[model samples]
Target: MTRNLLSILPVLALCLWLCTAASSRLVKRSDDLDPLEAVVSQLSQTVAGLQAEIAALKSSKADNAVLLALQTQVRSLQTITAEHKVAFLARVDVDVAANAPIPFHAVDFNVGNAYDPLSGIFTAPHSGVYLLSTQIFPQFAGDVLVDLYKNGGIIIRMRVFDSTSPTSESTSITDHANAGDKYWVQVNVGGHIYAGAHSFFSVTIVFPDS
Candidate 1:
C-alpha cells in the first residue's frame, strides 16, 4: 500500500509542472498578438493621411491651370480690341486743274476760307502719320506752300520751290490731324501767271499696301 501511494505522488507532481508550462505559453502568445495589431493600425493611419495630402495637391494644381488659361484669354481679347480701332480711316487721291480756282472737296472736318487760286485742301480721315505730295505739269514754274490745320488753327506750314515745269514736292506729318483735321496748299505764282488751260496738279495720300 505504501509503495503505491509514493508512485501516485510522483505522477501528480509531473502533471502540475506540465499545466504551468502551458499557461506561460498562452500568455506570451497573447502579448505578441496585441503588439502586432497596434502596428497594423498605425500603418493604416499613415497611409490614409498620405492619400489625403495627395488629393489636396492635385486639386491645387488644377485650380492654378484654370486661372492661367483665363488670364491668357483676357490678354488676347485686349489685343483684338486695339486692332479694330485703327481700321476706320481711308486713304484717297485728289486731282486739281493747275491755275484753276481752288476746287472744294467735302470732308468730315470743317474748312475755312484758306484757299488760293492755286491752293487746295485735304482733310484727315483719322489721326496718324500722313505723307503729302503734289505733282505739277512742267509748263508752270512756281513754288507750293502747304499748311496743316487743326480745329481752325494752323499747326504746320512748309514751302517747296522748283524752276523746272514738272516738279514734285513732299512732306510728312508725324502727328497728323485726327479725324476731321484740315489741310491746304497754296501755289506761289512767283513771276509766271497761271493760265487755267496750261497748268495741272494732283495730290495723293501715300499708304502702305495691306
Candidate 2:
C-alpha cells in the first residue's frame, strides 16, 4: 500500500500542474481557444478523478488496519482459552485406607496434567471456577464416609451403608479455586472403599478467572 501511494504521488502532482497551466493558457489565448478550452476541461476532470481515487484508497487502508487488529485480538483470546482448559476422570482400582486421599489409580483422562493419580490430588493449573465430583462404595459395607477436600479442608461429605450388599454414593461441588489450590476425595471415617469402577473422581474447569 505504501509503495502504491508513493508511486501515485508523482503522477498526481504532474496532473495538478498540467491542469493549472491549461486553465491559465485558456484565458491568455484567443486564436484556437476552443482546442485549449477542451484540453483544460479534460485536465480538470482527470485531476478531480485522481483526488477521489486517492481518498478512497486511504479509506480502504484504514479499514484494513482495523480488521487486522481485530483478528489478532481473537487469536490471543483463543490461545488463553486453550491454555486454561483443565479436566480429569479417575477411578480407584484398590481399597483406600480411612483418613487418606483415595488414590484413584485408574485414569480415564487427565487433559492438563493437573490431576495426579499417584497422590489422588488435583492441583489447579489456573484460577477458575471448577466442578469436582466423586462416587464411592464400601466393599464389605458396614458403613463408609467419603469427604471432598479442598486444600485439605472438607467441602462436603457423603455416607454410604448397607448390611446385605455394597452401597454407593456420589457427590459433587462447584466453586472457585486459585492456581495451585488442591482438591481430593478421601475416606473420612469408616474403612476401605470398594475397588473398581464403583468409586470414581473427576475435576473440570468451568470457566477461567478473568
| C-alpha lDDT of all candidate models, in order | 0.44, 0.85
Per-residue accuracy of model 2 over 1-210 as CA lDDT, tens digit each = 646766876776786587667667565556756676676677667657766777888899999999999999999889888888899999988778888888999999999999999999999999989999899888776778788999989889898865687788998889899999999988877877788888999999999988
Q: Residue 48 of model 1: what lDDT?
A: 56
The most accurate candidate by TM-score is 2
TM-scores, one per candidate: 0.33, 0.65
Deviation (Å) of 16 in candidate 2: 28
lDDT measured at residue 23 in model 1 versus the true structure, 0 to 100: 48
Worst 10 residues of 2 by lDDT: 25-34
lDDT of 1 by residue, 88-186 (tens): 111112444433333433222322222222234455554555554322222346665544444455555545466656454444454444555655443
**Error of model 1, residue 160, in angstroms:** 2.5
Candidate 1: where is the Cα deviation over 4 Å? 1-139, 176-210
Query: Which residue pairs clash within candidate 2?
Result: none
In angstroms, the error of model 2 at 47 is: 22
